[model samples]
Target: MNQTIALIGNPNCGKTTLFNSLTGTYQKVGNWTGVTTEKKIGQYRKDKKIEIIDLPGIYSLSATSLDQKSALEFLTKTPPSVIINLLDGTNLERNLSLTIELCALNIPMIIAVNFSDKLEERGVKIDLNGISKIFGVQAVCISAIKTKNLDELIDLAKTTTQKPFKISLTAEKGENSAVKRFSFIERNLDKIIIKKGTTAQNKTQIADNLLMHKTLGLPIFFVIMTLVYFISIKLGGVFGGVIKNLFDDAGERLSIYLSEKEVYPFIQSLVCDAIIGALGGILSFLPQILILFAFMACIEESGYASRIAFLFDRFFRAFGLGGKSLLPMIVSSGCTATGIMSTRIIEGEKERKMTIFLSPFIPCGAKTAVFSFFATSIFGGNALIASSMYFLGVLCVGIFGRILKNLKVFKNNKDEFLLEIPDLHLPNLNDVYMVIKEKIKEFITRAGLIVFCVSVFLWLLKSVGLSGYVADRVEDSFLYVLGEVLKYAFYPLGFCNWQTAIAVISGSFAKEAVVESLCLLTNDVGALFSSSYSAYAFMAFILLSPPCVASLATAKTELVSNKWFFGMLAFQTLTAYTVAFIINMIGNIFVWCGGLLLSLIIVIIIAISLIVAVKILSKSKCCACTNACGERKCKNKEKHSTI
Candidate 1:
């Protein structure tokens, strides 16, 4: 008979890490909460029949957040044969609270203490035998990262037997269950756990004091992100140029060989221009993507990500988001779909929906290709321009968040932020390798499947006309007619050419398709833009536009309502167009009015127009109540005060 085991624990207790070690799966693991927001299943490597289910990290059985609800539902509906109660060795006191809750379920369990390797460095010790004797379950100390004593843990799990253990609380009579549980833990903890000193904790505290300073914290974060982009874009570009040249040479050689071999002219264009050219342009940015993922992995594994969430909590609350929202936003930099899924960790429904609506503003890895291309070709290879797009996305999120918070639909009565900070340590090299490896695999897979298919379809559209097979006359092709019809919509934002219009439209399918379409349409991408100003406007449009089809589908599922999903789509489209139009108008002012004074006057006038527009849009329909205002208490004492 096959036995099923479930791994359950407090957030960041190394349950996912141990699952990966036992099951040999490459599931993403980080030193922060919400990394595993959904349950994952994999077979035990040693015995395939023994299934391992890695459930989302939960503090207690009380289902408050979406992730907790999922875990709770799964445990109650389908009780596993055995439960691996993973505990963080350094923070056993807090972790034991959940263990106490799980004990009430009466399921056979094995207590696996994680981070045992760090106990000595942190001046702490745990007696495994003593814990086993006290808890009435088999207990073992194991280091998931180091893969130490994992075999012993598995052995204990296989032969796990539950013993009747009752918690006798000595607290006050009216104490809550939580207080009673902690009281029991405090009374019994001294027997099995020993604390020698706080040497390691002191060092971490000293570092946090400087890094998390009130004034310096935000600036430090910006500096770190800027440096990450600098290394990823500027340094990686050197390698990208080499790859581009190789592809260019190969395309040239293949085209020549096809022509010499008397191949069909249409076939030659399809193979050389559409397939090779488009793939080359995108594949050139692989180094930069790899480097960016590496830096993100390092930040997550080094335990600085959770500190960022904590540091930004107060700041985020002002914009109607809790600090917990930052993790999803951070993950959005890689993939908006995954980021939307991560919002399950947020406790409030209003905040989670708002986060889902705003997360697509952040440029995902697909948009990274588009930005990198423009930065290299038009912006004089300045990585700052590409990196600034990220901050621009954040600015949009903040501006929209403030506006939406005042609206009745998105208003939150109270936003609570809760996060557990993990200890700082050097990133495990193996974990970093796995992250980079998985990211590369995804990138290549998309390039192979989506990009390849889109490139071929686009080539056919550009090749055939009303008369069919236009050959060299691309102006007479079917794609040109379609682009011509849509070009007028983008006239105010600059880049009114058909090619640029087509590229933007294709981006709705896949953001990377923007770059692929552009490469497939024209040999000189710079020629599509009239000036650098127009290029910047186009880039801004891409930055703020609704994400790709997959992301839209994800938003629909996450939002769980057609009305809100369509509202989000409309909001994103309008925001993108309005921002891009403003940028283009401002750039034209600088060009048309050469004098600095005149340009400044025009810019001020435009800014004033924008301010007025925002004020008008933000005007709320007041309710006849003393506290009608969503974000603030109404100043009017009379219920019939003037609107």
Candidate 2:
């Protein structure tokens, strides 16, 4: 008979490392009860008869967060035959609180007291047998990371018999045996364990003192982020270059073959310029986008992000935002859809709302290609000017969040937070590869399907001109009319032609389409539109525009509200137009009328920003604070009292 063994533990308990060891790459998936969080299952390497379920990393069974609720549901509802409860040996007091609850189920369970090495070096000891006796279950000592005594743990798990069900001793029962279990273990500790050098602990303690210092932590976080962005951008460029070359070669071949075949003008335009132009243009940059995601995944897997969250939590709260929002914002700097999906982890209502409202300010992955191509090709890579746009993204979100909080959109919410700071560790390459593969797959799936259809539709729009193909002349196409209408709006940017506006419109599908469309329009696809000021202005516009239609659709799906979806688009467009106008004006400093208009626009946008900030911080009455930080998933309602 096969045994279904569930590995359960608190977050940062090395639970993932343990699962990686037991499963050895055989993990299968399902999502737990109510949410989209994944459920992992795998056949044991040593015993195919034994199956393992790696539950979410949760601290308790109180059903606090959606993640916690899923774990509790799996434990109470599924009733695995054997539970491998991996408890952090150093934090036994807090960790054992949950073990006491699990013990109530009375199913066979083997406690794997991990991190025993760290405990022994701390001059602390644990009596494993004594804990087993009090809990009426088997307990094994194993270091999952080092594979110490792991075979014995696997053997013991195989033999442990199911104990009859029993309730944990409660305070009402007068014994409170959870504490008794700790006392029993402590009394026998000296005989069972030993201590050695305390160097690692001392070093970590000293580092923590400085790292967690209130005055210095925030500044240190900023310094680290500056370094991460620097490395990510530099590395991404190398990878993007290789991918773009392959795409460029393929595109050249296709265009040359079509020209040789003597295809008609409108048909050629529809096939090459519209359809292939849009999708192929952005698909070429998948390498850079994947590289950026891989870099973030490595950091997250190594646990640097948790410390980052701790360092920034209080700062975000001052703007009525959450520290958890940092991860989404950072991810959004690569892609907004990924950023929006990441919001699911934020527990507080105010925090989640604020993150959703502000995530668009980050320059997504697609837009960065525009920055790279334009910055180097046109301006010879002016680092200071290029970097200013990144800071502008941050400035927008911070100021926007503060301003919105005082409005009807966020009247009754004052954000507050608590976070668990996991220790830094080496990132697993397997995990890194897995993340990169998933992101690349998502990008391809979208580019091939949605983007392909949009490209074909755009081709149809550009094909119906009045003269050569469909009507009297080449200038009367369906797309020409729309482009002509938009020409005046972009007059200040110095590229006031219909082709530039049409490129911006098609760019809603994929950002690189702007450059590609311009290339197609002028029949010189490489380094053709080399106006540096105009290039800078156009890149800025694409960066700040509403995220592609795919991302907006994803936002609607995730938020489950059209209200949030439309609101994001409206805010994004407003910010994009305003930012673009400012950049265009500044770029045209030598042009008299453009420079004057740009100065006036800057003054107006800044004054509006100040008024918005004043309005968001205005106070409001609320009775929601008591349990606001205490719940998650947001499906349950809490009883409230008047403040």
CA lDDT, candidate 2, residue 532:
58
lDDT of each: 0.83, 0.68
Off by over 4 Å in 2: 1-3, 20-51, 115-127, 142-161, 164-200, 209-220, 253-280, 377-380, 450-453, 456-476, 482-505, 510-518, 521-538, 581-643
Scored by TM-score, the top model is: 1
Q: Write out the backbone clash pairs for model 1.
A: none
Please give, for residues 63-134, the per-residue lDDT of candidate 1 as tens digits: 466677888888889999899999989888889888888877788889989988888766687887878777
* C-alpha lDDT (0 to 100) for residue 376 of candidate 2: 66
Candidate 2 global TM-score: 0.76
What is the lDDT, from 0 to 100, of the residue 398 in candidate 2?
80
lDDT of 1 at 371: 91
User: Residue by residue across 62-176, what tens digits does model 2's lDDT show?
Assistant: 6457788888888889888888888888667667767766777778888889986667657666777667666677887777767677778778878888573354343434555
What is the TM-score of each predicted model, taking all chains together?
Answer: 0.91, 0.76
Superposing all C-alpha atoms, what RMSD in Å does each candidate have to the true structure?
A: 4.7, 6.9
